[model samples]
Structure formats: C-alpha cells, structure tokens
Target: MPFENEFASYEPLRRILDNEKVQQLQDRLKVRAIEHDDETISEEITEKSQVEPSEYQPDMVLAIDGSYQAVKVENGFPGAEIGYVTVASVLILLEKIRELEREEFIDPKQFRETEKAATIDAVFPGCNVIVDDEDSAKSSMRRILFDELKNHIVFSEGETLLDTYEALLKIKLEQKSTPSRCPHDNCDAEFTYDYGEYQCPACGGKLYSSDAMRLHELMNPVGSNGEMYGQIMQTLEKLWLIHILRAFEKKGWLMTLRRVAFMMDGPLAVFSTSSWLTKAIIIELHRLNELAKKFTKQDLILLGIEKTGTFVNHFEDLDTTKEGVADKFPKQAALLLHDEYIKKNIIFSESLKPYGKDTYFGRKFFYKTSLGYKIVPSVAFFNEYQQNLTTARPNQFTRLADVMSLLDQVVSSRYKNAVTPLVSAHAEASIPLNLGRRIFEDIAREIREQS
Candidate 1:
C-alpha cells in the first residue's frame, strides 16, 4: 500500500489558474491575440529561394545515432528499478545523390541501371546496464554497458575502442558536481549535496554514480536517471562517430574527406554530462582541420540534421511571418529563425525559453528543401558559449559562413528537410523491440544472485 497511490486532484489545476505566472502568461497571450488578429495585421506571401548548382559535392555521406529506453519491473519488488539498454548504429551512404542534381537530365532508366546507393548500416548489437534485479544487484552493469558499446563500435582507421572509452570516462569525471539529478526517478530536483547532506533535499531519497571505489551506502542509492543514462549512451555513440571521422585526417585522404559528408541524427550541440566531450571534440576538429587542410582537398562536410525542436514545432506551422509588414519578410529558407520573426508570427511563443547560449560547435540554421519540406541543419565550427541570454541578437546565423560550399553537399530531391543518407541511417538505427529490449532479465538475475 505504501508504494501505491491514487490521483484524484483537479485542485492543482484550479490553483494554477490563479497563479501569478499563469496570470502573466494569460495577459501576454491576450496582447498577442490583439496584435496578431487577422483584421489588424498585414501579411504577404514569401517566394521560394533558389539553390544554386553544386559549387561542391561529396561522394559519400554517413550518419550516426542511437536508440535507448529503460523498463521498470513493477512485478518484481516494491522499490526496485529494472533494466536499461542502448543500441548504437551507424549508416554510411556510398552513392552520391548530388550527382543527380548535377546531371543535365535524369533518365530514369539510366539512373536505375547506372547509379544508386543505399545506406550501409552497422549495428552495435546492443548494450545493457543492470539497474535492478528485484533483489540485491550490486554489480557494476554500467561499466559492462560502456565496455560492450566500445567493443562493438565501428570507426575509421586510427581509432580504437579503448581510447574512445578512456575519453568517455574522462568526460564523466569532468561533469560539474553540483546541481545533479535527484535520487528519485519521478522527481527531477537538484540541490546542494555539499555540507554533509545525507538525503535528497527534494524527495528525501538518494542517488549515485556507479563508482566502485566509493561505498554505495555513503553515496546516494539511486543511480543516474533515465535522461542521464540515455545521454551517456548518446555520448558514447557521438564520440565513436567523431573519432572515426577524425581518423580520416590521419589517413590524410583528402579525397575521401572531401567527398564524404557526415550527418549526425540530432542537434550539433551536446547536452547534459556529455557537453565537455563535445567541447573537446570541437577543439580537436579545429586542430585536425588546421593540420589536414594542407594535405586534404576540402574541409570536412559534416552536418547535424534534426526533425524536431522548439523552432521545428513552431516553424513547421508557419512558412513566413509577414504581420504588419510589406512583402519583405525573410523567407524561411536556410535562414536563422530570427528573433524578429519569432515576435511577429507568435507561433508557440509561450513554449520558447530564454536561449541558453552555448556557442554552437556547429552553425544552426533552417532550410526548406526543393521538395518544400522545412528541416533544421547544422554544420560544425569552432565557437564559444555565450552565457548572457538577454542580448537582442543571440548569435542566430542564416547558414555557416565558412562552410558555404558545404551547403551544396545536402542532396535534396525526393526528401524534404532530410538528406538521402540520413533517412537510410535512421532506418538502420531504429531499435526494434526484439533487437534492443531493456536488459530486464539480465538485471533480475544479477540482483537475485547478489541477494
């Protein structure tokens, strides 16, 4: 009965209606309604922009991503958590889609016969972290997960699994100690663990990392949360790809690096505990590029393509914002979703947060493909974080300045916001239930054995 509960509360909703924050939002919404009313506002259509013929092209493109989820064992015990797993995958596009764009005419018959490519998928079987076995699972399963992920990793020449893992551990150590996750899975709270704090200030529970040297009882009992664990998996997946791609520099094969574009499945920026690793990656790429340019023909064509976000959700609904303006609103074509446009359209405005200014390792921008589908794309660059979020212009960029030629690398015809390679990669990387279930059975066994 202690672990069980019933929900029968509309009181919170009623209270929220009267809350100051809610009232302020209501006042703001009312003003927005008046300002953006169709009768009072002026609008115009935004014409499509043209993409120039390829100034540059990549012969191949690669994409990398991972799927992760955790499953709790309700039948096991009162307070027991269960299993977590991650499946990392990489997809390589060997065929060049840009070739079709360059060709004067596409003869369907010739196209079918002569040139076509599919994404080559390499799956990292899967890795499991035993969170709970319904009994006493004290085994260090996180290490096992990390180890297996490294073992199954695929990278280009000159990269090693051991080196990648050591790098990952270094990142884990570098994370800031304060403001960490709460000990309870349901409560995402952070407070001072300093000053001999024995329990989570938020839930009176505790949490921990899987450090063997420390006594488990001395540390917070609960381990990483779902979000943090997924991030850890993603961190490994990201580093694996970066290291592999970087090995090309050691190969000194400018021809391959030039013809190859790498598409990461998420935003160019790293988040959570993995941010340090991303920062290091940014620095390393700059260093490698500085040395490789003299030997290689062109800069690496790397991109991060995202299907959704705050910008994606709102902009997906609006092609152009022209309220109270002439026919001069910036078209949503490879432009930064500028602050002005954000104010004008007012699409999903309440959800927008004060931009946490991390100088992007990649330049973020929106692009409307030839097929008229809007997608966000980012190209890598060495940049620093901007801590102040109040500036009028938050460093929103239209497209990458230095990587102008790389824009040509995106192949747009059959697809909308996505390049052809990313689509294939996604297909390959998607974790089916059978292939990547949470390691519940393994977790249960481990806990039972330990008990």
Candidate 2:
C-alpha cells in the first residue's frame, strides 16, 4: 500500500482498538485517582515535629551517580557490541558551600572535579572472539566485573573497591561459600566454593567473587547488554558509598562518618538482576551506623534522594488541591510509605509480597522539604527488615529532620527538582551521546581495520 493510503485507512488498527476485549484490558490497566484527604491515609504523612535543626547535622556531603551507554561495533553475522559505564562521586564540603554563601569567588567546577570517577569497558563474546563456547559472554563479563571491582581506585591508594565489596560480602551475607552453575554451554553442573577465585570442576570454567551479584544471568552470546550494564552502574554507585565509608572506618574516622551525609542519586534499593545484593547492603549499612553511634555518640547519615519516579509523581499529586480542599501532604512533613498506601495509590494493585520486600534495602518516604522541594528519599534502619510497616512511623527515621535540613542547602536551580551535588555528579559522569558514539565508532573502526 502507498504511504498515504495506509495513513488514511486505519481499518486494521481500528478493529483492534474497538475490540471489547481490548477495552476490558484497558480498564484493568487504568490508573486510579489519588485520594486528596482521608483520615486513614493522613496517618502516613507526619508533620515535622522538630522546629529546630537537629544537633547532629552533617558538615560534608558525598553524592554518587552513574551513567552508561552501549553501541554496536559490527552489524553483519557474528556482530559485536561494547558498553561504557562511568560512575562519579562528588564531594561537597559545607564549608565550601558556606564560602559560596559568603560570596567568595570559587570555581564551581572544583566541586565536581574530584578524584572519584571511574569508567569501565564491557566487552561481549562477539566483540572479543576469545570464547570457546556460548557461555563466553557470561565468563568475560564476570571477569571484567571482578577485575574492575578488585582494582578500581576510588578514595585513595590505601584500599581498593574490592576491599569494601569483600568486607560487606563477609559481614552481611556471611557466605561460607559462593556458588554458581557452570557457565559453560551444555554443562549445567552446580558448584560451591569458598570466597575468592575458583573454577567449575565439571567444565573448568572460571568464577569470580563478583558472581554474588548474579549479573551473569542477564548475559547472552550476542545481543543488547544494556540492562546488564545498567545494573553494573547501579551496583558501582552503591559500592562507592560503602567503599568510602569503610575507608573512614578503617582509619578511625568515626567522627567524619557521623558528620558526613552520604547521598546517592537514586533509591537505596537494588532491583532486578541484582536484587539479592540489597539485603546484604542493608545489613552492612545498619551495622556501620550502629558502630558509628557506639563510638561517636551519633548515627552516620546516609540516604538516597530520587530526582523523579512514581513516588515523586504521587507526592506531586498529593500536594495539589482537590475539590477546594487543602494540600494532602503539608510542607515540612515526611510521609513514610507503607505497603497498603503504596499498593492502593501508586502501583494500583495488590500483591502477596509487601512493597519492596524482596528488592528494597530501605524504607522510601515522600518529603516536602521545609524549603519546599518535593523529594523522595529512602532511609535504611537496623530494624527495617524486622519491623512491621503498619507500626513504623516517620519518627523512626532518626535522620529525617537532619536530612531535610541538609537538603535545603543543596537544592539546585540548574536542574528541576534536584540537589546540587547529585546534579554535579551526574554532569561529571554523563557521556554525550553524539560525542561518545562517534568516539566508540572510531575505536570500533580502528579495531576492524587492525583485524
């Protein structure tokens, strides 16, 4: 058919759209309106009781963010793909912020130009042609992930990022042995071995400590590894926080930990292919916080700030007027989202598992800062896994007031509904699509020529 003929006649599309079964399906997927004000739901949002800033406010902030991109290197049979991931952690001192407030001239670039940025290259099986079997992609990915985790320089030369990874894997998961099925094609033998490097006995396939992330499950011989690369970026962001904090702990910098609020660009939860790491992270952070309290007489401040998501949307909706009624979520208040509220209002479905039960390491809350930024923040508690959602209150998050107070300082004008440190971290980590693709393409061309 001609282009105009196809455009003019929508008979086939109309038949599908006008079908009764399609209408029923649409009804099932429709989003429900958020309730403006109801007595039962109102309990979730608790107005800030702390009229004064808490005694223990963080003097320094470390924010982590990451970005990733993948490109096809070749297009014919036995094609190839490569991915690049950049994770950046920016350190913002309150003193420098105060200097800015004092109108002292200091270049803003200094804040983002910290020594905590790392770029990792991911090569798939087709891209390298170093494989003996179909499982080569998984094997190669596992090696790259392990080597990067073990060698990436983060804060200083005193320790590698793997030290944090290994420490947490030991302290939280308490894994006596790391186990995995053979990554060799046609060899489905499962094996369990002690931590560190090992090989599958049945197939002589190599294994890695980073295998705990289970990212290999997402790998294939030749296809898009975007999702897997994304998960790696998220994992790196989370590890960067723990790595620096652990470094501080090792150096007896408990007071520094207490006075520094570690911020991440997204939620504290690890989801999808790497969800299993969430529980271990939660336990590790809880332990670190407890240790900080025991030694420094205050809890370490660490939280994740979301720039945008479903929860943020729900929060914006809550603040809007409905039928001449006042805002549902008041300013300077934080709402600890429980399972019932999230299921009913946000996801619009009921599930046997509680909201974020399997995937989340922290409790997510909707906060309207005292300065009026509607933000979603996730906070982890030692008892987060043990406590019932029905009984937990906003007050249980001891650092909520301090976090809100700190957020007021970093609210960004450069980005909509984002904080300064995260904005800076993102800028430092991001790869320009046009420039990056051109560079990757050039590199791919050189490789093709050399071959």
Local distance difference test, per candidate?
0.46, 0.67
Clashing residue pairs for model 2? none
Which whole-number lDDT from 0 to 100 does residue 273 have in model 2? 66
How would you encode candidate 1's per-residue C-alpha lDDT over 1-451 as one tens digit per residue? 3345876578977998889998888877634333343332223222233333233455444566565554544543333443344433333333433455478887776554222122111221112223443112333333343345444433233445445544444444555444555434467787543321155677765332322112121222354345544554565556656656554544454444544566777777766644555555666666665565565544565678777666665445445444533222233335444333554453334445533234346655555544455667766653333212223122322124323333334444665456655655455445433343323233222222322
Query: Best candidate, TM-score-wise?
Result: 2
Q: List the residue pairs that clash in candidate 1.
A: 59-259, 207-220, 359-385
Q: How many backbone clashes does candidate 1 have?
A: 3
Give a tens-digit lDDT track for model 2, residues 1-451: 5675455557878999999999999989767765636665566567666444557677666677888877666545464676678776555666656755666566767643322333333333324334444345567667777777776644344577877787766754564455567656779998763357887788776777677777778765556777877888888888877776666666565655656677788888888766767777777877787878876676666678887888878777777666645355667777777777788788776667777877776677777766677778877666654335555564567567787777777777677668887876687678522222213223222222322
lDDT of 2 at 425: 69
Task: TM-score each candidate.
Answer: 0.58, 0.82
Per lDDT, the best of the predicted structures is 2
Clashes of each: 3, 0
Give candidate 2 regions above 4 Å deviation: 1-16, 27-44, 49-53, 74-78, 104-135, 155-157, 171-179, 323-328, 384-387, 431-451
